[model samples]
Target: MSAVHEVAPVVDAAHAEPYATRDEYAGAIGRIRSAAEAYYAGADLVMDDAAYDALLARVAATESAQPGWAASDSPTTTVAAGIAGGDVEHSTPMLSLDNVFDGDELASWAARLERVLGRPANGYTVEPKIDGMAVAARYVDGRLSQVATRGDGRAGEDVTVNARLVAGLPAELARPVTVEVRGEVFMTDADFERANELRTGHGGTAFANPRSAAAGTLRAQDRAYDAPLSFFAYAVHDLPGGEGLFHSAAMAAIADLGVATTAGPMAAITEPGVTATTTPTAATTDPEATTTSSPPAGMPLCATIDDVLAAIESLGAARGSLGFDIDGAVVKADDPADRDRAGFSSRAPRWAVAYKFPADTRTSRLVGIEVQVGRTGVITPVAVLEPVQVGGVVVTSATLHNFDDLVRRDVRVGDAVFVRRAGDVIPEITGALLDARPDGATAFMPPQVCPRCGGEIDRSQKRWRCVRGRACGAEESLAYFAARDSMDIEGLGDKVIAGLVRAGLVTDPADLYDLDAESLAQLERLGRTSAAKLVATIQGSKTQPLSRVLTGLGVRMTGRSMSRRLARHFGTMPALQAATVDDLQRVDGVGPERAATIAAELAELAPVIAKLTARGLTMSEPELPTRPAAPGSAEALEAPRLPLQREDGSPMTVVVTGSVPGLSRTEGNEAVERLGGKSSGSVSKRTDLVVVGDGAGSKATKAEELGIPCMPAEEFATLLAQLTAVRLG
Candidate 1:
């Protein structure tokens, strides 16, 4: 166990002064160490990396100011401590890299190193800081011996069996030399998706992100059932070393031993206003250097700070194209001797620092809290924030998710809060800075009554809802009903819906048919011309197919595709209204729970359906050619054949994926349906065929795995033509 204590002071203020006492500094150091241990253990983080770095900097500054008061085993002087999972001790400490947020900080670090050396340093090496789980692998006599995770800097969990199963990690080295190699294990975005699909298929919870997926897979006891993971060597240590090689040379040596590194040769960083000298390092001076296998190609060398910045920029630009995730880039001193002279800090090497890219999180003041009623009548709280930029977008509002989250985060009006763009969209308040909170800022309580309709609130469930049902969420429902994929009602938007709801002119979708130019023209912003156009559009919507009408109804768990399937299965609104739960469940993708929900929603909306039907809306499917019975045929006597039925006299289950030439994905699914086949969004064992199109990804792979027949777009089109001809004939 590491002697460094793991606890840290919580600095809740954004601009609070540094620690004034040794106790305060010690607390901050302990907190940082604890957070790092949790992070390495794949547990929930108490604070984000930005906050962790701030506290770490404070501890470092405090130690520098009063060295006599500093503990001998302080976190600042030790590598990250290990957790209890792994029993294997590392030959050398796996130090965590210190981080700098921007170019200025990076330059300052570089300048500090040069100043310590009393002259300009030789150069620097830059590489990506892959966001993944770190592990050290030991090779004995060119054979795979053992692998351990970075449990704490000194010891890690032994995971040799699991490590051997990773796709890209080499099981054995080419040469018979005892060595230890350190690298990261990660999962690509594509692998993460596949892993989630497999997990959900087997009734398991899906992982939240790629890094978590990789970590969980590496640590799982059942290695055979774990998801696929990849590895990349970043550093190497020879057991019987003669001399230390340059960082780049060490990476090349690992690559030569049949292990894959993150990328080829590191980018070289030259000092400003100086020309880079092409001096060969010790590893390159070996007699067998020309004969030794070269590293995998395409790692570019950068000269000067501008060049390094450019390299970072280029990497950022190409981030989306990479198969794996990287949170930052590492800048390391190129000269091995210079690194030795700079020496090691307790937790990190002094010669290197990771330049972390700007995070998606930003601080903003909470101006107010607003309640919004969702289409399902659930009341959600939203934070109105003073406009702030996060993840390159200006965000004005963030979601509090629910009343529980609102209170849990303790976010209040006038409080400074940390806002982050979740998944690069959907701004959310991660936490509030209590130290910077205003004196008058008070806790916000969710309204007992619906904010929009003054309806009674039901707090019996985790998410509170309005007892008035659709009446409380009428505007939201109206907007969804008018959406392009739903009813496709033109000239009707949020503003129009709000106006109609405020004027009491529209209470439900059925009320849209009752609207007229005179009534609409009376609303704010709607003039004579606009009102006439809107009325005309509403009138035209009466001719829309049953699928659109079902989507417009806003049934829970029923979207465009499901609506279309339900419409096709029932043929008409009357048939659907009369369907039992079992009958509804017979449709593809409609399970028992969904069937129950659909049945209950339909039962509740019967009156609305009748009103819409009475108002002249189309409630039945369009007529299609019915197959004629063959003379004296026993099959003909049983039932009429649907237009979508296959020649074998059964409904074909087809999965349509990606974009098809000459037809949208929607059109492709509709084409399958028109021929009496069931169209599904996902490929499964039940699927009879998969219609693959351009950009077809995981679905195609799954179909191949299941041995389901796949057809190209042209073949599908040809099949559709044949089916149409046979149906018509």
Candidate 2:
């Protein structure tokens, strides 16, 4: 047996806190256990991966420093924090891996392994530590029988039904031999997109990340639709007539038997002629690649620990383009003999270690806490942070989600906090860096009344709301309505709107139409001439398109594109108001929740709509270009090709960035829709085109990076004119 040795107490830079007291240690342990439970149960995580890891490290350091202070039920002593439960017994313990954050820690781990073996290790194999759920699939006589999660190592929950549907995990193997395949179930980038589409289509909230999506989908028995899942085998066990085979050979053998392995095929090198190559060819072993009839490829076989480190570094460099998420690289002793000699720890195998990449997270100081009221009157606390770069973006502020979340996290002003871009996109403060907090830092108090109107608070839900609802934020609503992108009402700014609201002349958007030049002239700074011009602008706004009217109304879920869609689909305001939840769902991206929210908001604003209608506003959207006749029909052959549409007649998704000549951002987007293309707000891989203009920033950069076709604003303007002429003709 390998001698039991304590890991050296080396704190990662991210985990500098030593948990100086028992209370501190216990507090950390409690948080870690809670996070582990939420993670394994496929629920929304209260803490991010980085924060949890930091806390775990802090707990371990404290336990090491004060030996007898460790509790029996501490997360340090448990596999998966002892939260994940199951009834199915694994053939062998499904062990977790100890983590090493940097090359020094990794090298130290390697040295320990060498000491246990009483020699330099034979070789190492590095594979992506896919950020996914771990499972073991038992194949009886070459046919897949059952699958179970890696719950608490020794036993796991059976999920046979869901496992059968996963890609890369074939129901029947090429050879009908009894063996257990251990692998990860995860969602690829495409799979994640498809999953979100399906989920949102069915009225469910979209998942935050692919790992969580895979986990939830894998364990769910009552889902109305299946989200896609993928599997990659990392180890095989209990194969007939295959004892003492090198770990590399076993992996290749499994691949030959039609199981997917991320490390690809690794040729067993019994001789000294094998050399490692730096370039990545291991991606050819991806299960998606197998569909193109590519031959099975091999991953690098590292002859030494140095080579293993190089392979890990190469993998890290290639991470962003992999089309999948990997939190780290798993490096293992390649020889079965070496693994046998190293044996097992109570919670993990000594043969392997996970080299964790630093999380895309950073630390920033919380300068202040402020609350903002949304259109729905929900009061959310936002953190004003000292500018920090996280995931390639400078974040100055982050939403605390709600007051309850703020209290739960216990973050305070003057505290150095852990900041990460949640989903690699949104800036979020997970928790405070207590070790860096100032002596006088204190908890922030939630506003008992609405910050905007000083109205009574509705504290029934975690997200507190104001009793006055939309009326509480009337000035904000009016400002948006008169903004250049919406109604285009000139001379009406925030100060004017606030003065009008204070004078009780405007309580909702509908009240704005009731003001004449005489009433408007009574406001604080307005003169007769200015009020007359403002009134003329407000009256002229009545002639704006129905899409603009929808934008000005500030519907909960309807943005520019959505408003256009609703206006086009329903044609008139009356039709939209008459739409049922099911009818509203017919609009693109309008799922059940969004549809319900839209319907309820409309119903609440029925009086406002009546007032606007009485004021003779334009209520009907213009018709779209007439669709050509059915394909292969007589009219179809004679049909003129629609401008801005693909040959297949589908509308192109176009994004407009920066300023276009003589056009506001909203007008530019509207022009795209009017020209037979759909306008998107952001640039993504799927974006077909981008209209670039002066001062275009990240969106323009992203379009160029993605290789999406781009047109200059001048060219776009010319094209828009031509399209408009064609449509008119």
Give the best candidate by TM-score.
Answer: 2
Choose the strongest candidate by lDDT.
Answer: 2
lDDT of 1 by residue, 236-284 (tens): 7874452677777776666667676755442221221122111111111
Give the Å error, residue 582, model 2.
0.6
Q: Which stretches of candidate 2 lie over 4 Å from their true place?
A: 1-138, 141-359, 363-369, 384-387, 403-418, 423-426, 431-448, 459-462, 627-641, 657-659, 681-685, 694-708, 726-729
lDDT tens string, model 2, 1-729? Answer: 000001122235344567778888877777777768767776544555555676777887788888888988677767888888799999998988888888888889999999999998898888888878999999999888999999998899999998888877878888788899998888875676578678767776556456767888999988899887877778989977669887788877887787777655322211111121111122221110111111122245787787787677656655544556677788889889999999988777899998887564456678899999876687888899988655446789986767765765678999766565523334656556554468988889889789988899999866688998877877877887888877888889988998898898998877888899999999888999999998888888898878888888888766666788888878899999999999998876566767897898799878888898889999888646544435345564465555566665566889899889988887898888777687876565557999999999988876775578999999988887887776678
Reference-based lDDT, residue 239, model 2: 73
- Weakest ten-residue segment in model 1 by summed lDDT: 280-289
How many clashes does each candidate structure show, in the order listed?
18, 0
